[model samples]
Target: MPTALKLTTVQGNSLPIPGVESWHVTAKDPAMLVMTDFHWHSSVTVSENSTIDAALDHMKHTGVRCAFVIDGKMSAVVGMITAYDISGEKPVQHMRLTSTPRNEILVKDIMQKMADWHVANLKDIESATVAEVLKVFTDSDVTHIPVMEKNANNEQRLRGLLSFAKVKRLLVA
Candidate 1:
């Protein structure tokens, strides 16, 4: 048998901890308020072939309004899908156009293709303020903005994403 492990008992009922400093985000704050930085957080993703219902379920379970749709090999994002896309008129349009049943509709069928996405350069976003980001959101009437950066290979890679809902929740201006 191995040696017995030692366990320490509590020496006091209370421990001292530093108090958190409170701060409110303002329109002049860093654009990070509107962005989900991929470096610190994972993006919600779903297979392109997944049924719209399944994709919507995954988004609901993850508490995210948008997700990147990855291709079969899961090596590339071919499109984007949002809660609106899954629940909005896109589904009905696709069904009518393709004569497919609602249950058989796939994320790729209603998703906005990568080529159609309006994106922001990571470099531009790095220096942008919350107010500027909000302006882009309002002017473009877009709910999501995918941030891109060039990797060492000189190929553009998805870096982060900006969400209008997130910005609205954190915006003080």
Candidate 2:
């Protein structure tokens, strides 16, 4: 005979996403929120061909909601994958857009392409304090922003990533 399983519950206060709306800034002190001051989402990455399930696993272990989709080893960051991208309507949209079955969908299919994402310039990120990066969140519907840096070749390279959660957590605190 086996013993019955047991579970317990814990309670805590919740942090709310700042700003009344996507374009609004309801935080009392937006200046205290700097993208650099917060953690960026560039550490964990996944291949574009990885399945949504795989991306989810990576995020789960990394404690991040987003992953930069890399093409290959040391490759330029191509796209981004987030929990929302997988758990949200993106998969359904991908199915509709590509006529692919749910099982056939890959991260690449639903990832926000490089061309579709707006980024903060590395220089601006280095110089700007406060929640200037909040505008990136406000201007777009995305919770993450891929920051780009222009290198010696005058080409934009993947620098880091910013997310709305980090900004809002600090701002609302």
TM-score of each: 0.85, 0.69
lDDT of each: 0.91, 0.74
Per-residue lDDT of model 1, residues 1-173, tens digit only: 99999998979897666534434578998886568899889999999999999999999999999999999889989999999988889999998999999999999899989999999999999899999999999999689999999999999999999999888877775
**Best of the candidates, TM-score:** 1
RMSD of each: 6.4, 12.1
lDDT of 2 by residue, 1-173 (tens): 99899987756776556744433234444432344332343378899888888889889998889888888564767888889989999899888988998887898889988888877776776766545667667877989877777789997777676778877765642
Error of 1 at 117 (Å): 0.5
